[model samples]
Target chain A: MSVEAVTAENQAPPKPRRKLRNYLLDPQFQMKYVGMVVGVTFVVASVLGAFVYDFSTSLTDSMMANELLLDEYQGSASFQQIEERARAFDRFVLISIILGVLSLVVALGLTGIVVTHKVVGPAYKMRLLLSEIGEGRLSLRGRLRRGDELQSLFVSVEEMVDRLRAEREEQIDALDRAIAKLRAGDDRDQALASLEAMRDQMARSLE
Target chain B: MSVEAVTAENQAPPKPRRKLRNYLLDPQFQMKYVGMVVGVTFVVASVLGAFVYDFSTSLTDSMMANELLLDEYQGSASFQQIEERARAFDRFVLISIILGVLSLVVALGLTGIVVTHKVVGPAYKMRLLLSEIGEGRLSLRGRLRRGDELQSLFVSVEEMVDRLRAEREEQIDALDRAIAKLRAGDDRDQALASLEAMRDQMARSLE
Candidate 1:
């Protein structure tokens, strides 16, 4: 095979890899992250709840004491003033209790939601993706839940896979054609040249 | 195409839809299943906790009532007996409270572990698998968690795919040979016969 023929075959355009569908990163551990959150929530809520419980007890006692004083000293103050002050104290405890309870509930719910979405939700999604890959759907692309590191990682891997598959396919195709021409009894020189060129191309593409 | 060639090609293996890798059922959704369990666990634990709180209140009241009776009926009962009964009641309450508290703690822990394994663990694993898939590892078999329908499903799909890919490669090779022979003009009749056989095989395999 002429050197020119060899060079021409070697220079055949590389085929783009099939966009690889990545199934990397099990995403199963998101459950652990979620578990951590649940654990933390319980701890935090317990601590905060204990504080609220203590504060409520103290406030109730203090208000009751103030009530006793107000009743005993009512004659010294205007009725309106005494009543207004008592009302204000009552309102404070009531509001504090309400706020504390509401905050605790809100925090708990948010923690649950955050944990579920961040961990549980992704797990379910990963299962879906793995199944897709298992089904021989190599063309699948992983879409991360949001613009996060995880998502970036998946996307980047998928992109790399695609490049690799494309390159591989190109070499395989070139090898196939070279083999076919050689099999068809093209002049021995030309076929040999093509074979050498295809091999070089395959190696380079692999690299 | 000769009858012999047609028969040879037609004898090729069958094909399948959606290659399965293992015996897992919906292997892709295993993580989802785990997440669901975790979600259910959290919900159940919260509910149980609420019940525990209510039970604690009722139990405390009952203990208090018993205490009051002990005090009020002191004259009827011997001092020692009264003390003994009070102690008994105290022990009962203490035990019940301990059990209730223990249950809560245990339930919380289990929920964490379950959520961690199912939701978090799978996500990371899936990410890795996907990454590998993305890296052009077409032969990657999604690892199946043990003793689940998902694993079975994965296996089933993988098997199907393997069979089909093998069949396709075989057909491609035969087709190439037939075409090559036809082009060489040495055995056009035989090549044509082989082509017909391969076509038949392809049809049967797809079915």
Candidate 2:
């Protein structure tokens, strides 16, 4: 591979694995987004509702004027027909407003869930990994699927564990060497002094 | 109190404590319930949508028949007017159906959230508590707000912790006694034998 290509490949992050079942992962994180969507829908519903109301009102007024003019000529059938039309229109407007709001809310809720899943899935995994590490399971590593949020968090945690493991290994190696020296016929006083010094260094390293 | 009343009171389960922020405590547990509601709403919407279509179709057919008769008699004004009314009513029905579906979806989505909160809240708390315990903070307790779901889970975990603490305390006491016996001027062999016995018992208890 070309040097630039190799550098680019090395810089690229690991790909995330696919999840088995996509359930709602992070309800808490998605709640605010859902709220915002619902709020916008509510506003839209209100505006549309007002428009429907105004349109129906104008239709009603026009129908009433037609009915009033027809009354002078004794056209009862036309008047009744106009009245029925106006009532039907009014009912239509009401239904439109209700359905519009409902559909909006459901759509928003589902969208929020999918979006939040990206965040919550990773969070749940991190929590489990952290718990294992906290229990002194230094072998445990953080891993997240592709498209998961908090990539930086995974990197930071892994780096922290790497440092801790390195320090612990070094301290253990020094202690082991000190004991081996004492056992291999070093002067008792000098060996004891060296072991004590090693102990202090171990303590300082831990700190 | 009357005997029957007293008996009834004694048999009744304890009331859940009241909480200040009395909303969305358990989302995880409520997931199935929310799904059911959404499913039912979808069915209802479908049925209502069909009804609206059928009703509007019938209305349109009647208006068409009337218009055909009026057209034959050269009553163009009446025919045009009837056609307009039918069109208006058709639009009204369409709007009503749309609004009905939208409103239902929104309402059901919001309801599902409230129900799910009751479950998700408690589940989240348990995760945190488990993490703490895994980190060796066994003294920490699992607590949920009033009226939260998974009350049994909290109780079970607390009992488990209680048993573990008791066992640990007993083991510590035994070790302390054994150490004290070894340090004090007891017969060396007898002290060692007793200490060994205590160690075996401690091991058995832990097992």
Candidate 3:
């Protein structure tokens, strides 16, 4: 391989740009939250929107009634102006309600995903590492993102693996000494074989 | 102890009512989400409230201007009615904005805590278990609540611990066989001592 290629291979791979699916590492967990917040906001907005509608409608009706009472005293141009203004107010309220609810859902949904990703992303990575450990591989080789939740948990797992690796080394050392001592003794082939088997098991686990 | 008390001791303690502190198991993590959702909602509400205010004010101003034009044609009683209606609409809009934003914050905040709690609670419990495992206690106990996030991750850790315990047992079994064989061989005392030491180390890790 070229020197630059080898150097690149030795270095950690470049971090991937986070995809939409990545932000939703645990969608059920995140969506349950987003749904509740958006749901509540929608209800609240609807109630207030209704109140604004009712109040404005009353104001418009009373204004129209006044315009009707003055029909004999006022021009048709004035009546048209009042009716047009009421319609404009109603249209504004309708637009506000639709736009308000739409933006709230979008904002809350994005926040929910980003927030839950911090917790779920690290957990997803740790679980993969953990399953490897379950399969007898103690040489763990990954880390959580800097801002991920559960950093302390990840550290504990790393420490546990380190301790396991250290304990295995000690067991192997002791096995080596025992095997050496057995080699010097008479008719010790069987004991030496067992010791070697135990060492090999420990050695395999370390990888 | 009475029979009832003894039974109670053997049984798992009653699950505590989830406290506010428990819901906020990781305040910094949970709040970042709640704050973002609430902040966005607040900003959106403010912009829409401003739009509503501007729309209403222009409508009221035009009506008031019409009332002034009609002043020469009508009595002060009609003018009073239009002005009062305009002020009421203004008051209603202001109340809607305040109440809407207040309730939105309250609703989103509660939802944030409850939702993040599902993920954080399990993680918090698992971290404690992991640290215990780090200290060489492979016999894990306790489980995540049914609705909690990361159930699969918890299962993986449990499996890893079980594997480690099983490996330790096999290592101990091998050591036992080696020590027995060494006991039968010449000049085997030193070898037996090393084998016994290795077995003891493996046995200690199982706890």
Candidate 4:
């Protein structure tokens, strides 16, 4: 391939850097969002926990009553035997609830990190690019990591920079031609005409 | 105030709109997020429900056995009386669980809307402004609603546009002066020198 093609390819915005260190550039913002996720998850877990405790107590009472009625009618084994079985089941259920809540908390926390990272990372990249552009660096491009939110906004910003660069080049080219006409010892009328045309071109571009 | 001050104020970017209608621009993305919230909540509820059922059955069995042992030893009461109380508690607990889960679902759904709107609304505004800038309307500014998530990024973008507008005005002003010098019947040598200087100024601005 030609050298021009290679240069153009090289100039294409680099694939967004995805170093692990850079991924959490806006940790405070991400943290606030994650906290919201965790808050919601906690609400669900706590309410469910209350419901489980109450329902378990009620169901256990009924089961014990039925066992006693059977024992009294049939004159079966001692009450202690039935009591042991019921207590064991109670311990098993409580353990299950504890494990379930722990798993939910961990899962939600991880998901919160992944979701907020997509937003915060893109916002951080865009802010840096805007600052560079503000400082008159027209060649810099806006790029976002893959899976970032606001892809359309990034594309529009890149196009805005391209237009600004193109307009600047056009203005400079017009000025160059006007300057050359004056230096070439052109007649007064011709030189004046060139300058006016250049002026008009610049005015039109601003409009 | 001077007219210039008033003009400057007028040119200052308008405050972004914060209408409620505009805030839900990307409902599809927001819906997917809300769906995830609901899914996680559902998992926690289901697990808790199973645990409650097992635990309640176990505890009830033990309670009935103990009560039967007491009655046989002391002739305290009948099994029918205990059965009524157990059924009453079961009904109360089941109703409470139903109410608890319903409230949780509603609360989570509302939270999902609020969290997703904060993200979606800002992204929508930024995208719209970038498109206007891309189309050569450099005077247009980037503005965002207050309390938006990416406020810093939006401020940077607005400043970038301000810089672009100022540079364009400066270049046009330089071109106008050079044009006027060429037209004013000035010495040809002086006019050429001025044009060259204007060209350099434009070049520097682009750089």
Show model 4 residue runs off by greater than 4 Å.
Answer: A1-23, A62-99, A185-207, B1-23, B40-109, B140-142, B185-207
Q: Which digits, one per residue and each the tens of the lDDT, describe model 4 over residues A4-94?
A: 8898788976777866455566777777776777787676767677567555645655566667676776678568887786676567666
- Which lDDT tens digits does candidate 4 get at residues B21-82? 45467777776766776677666665655555444544555566666666776577798876
- What order do you get sorting by TM-score, best first? 3, 4, 2, 1
Q: Is candidate 3 or candidate 4 better by lDDT?
A: 3
Query: What TM-score does candidate 4 get on C-alpha atoms?
Result: 0.68
Report lDDT (CA) for all predictions.
0.46, 0.55, 0.73, 0.68
Q: In model 3, where do residues sit more than 4 Å from their true spots?
A: A1-19, A67-72, A78-85, A186-207, B1-15, B67-72, B78-85, B186-207
| Chain A of model 2 scored by TM-score | 0.69
Candidate 3: chain B TM-score equals 0.76
For candidate 1, write residues B1-207 as lDDT tens digits: 999888879886545443223223334443343344445444544554454445434434443444444445343556566456546644554554345445434544444444434433334454454455445343435565662212332443345335434544554566566545644667755755664565454333222
Ranking by lDDT: 3, 4, 2, 1
* Candidates arranged by DockQ, highest first: 4, 3, 1, 2
TM-score of 2: 0.43
DockQ of 4: 0.33
Stretches off by above 4 angstroms in model 1 are A1-47, A66-95, A107-149, A156-160, A171-175, A186-207, B1-207
Chain B vs. true chain B: TM-score per candidate: 0.42, 0.69, 0.76, 0.65
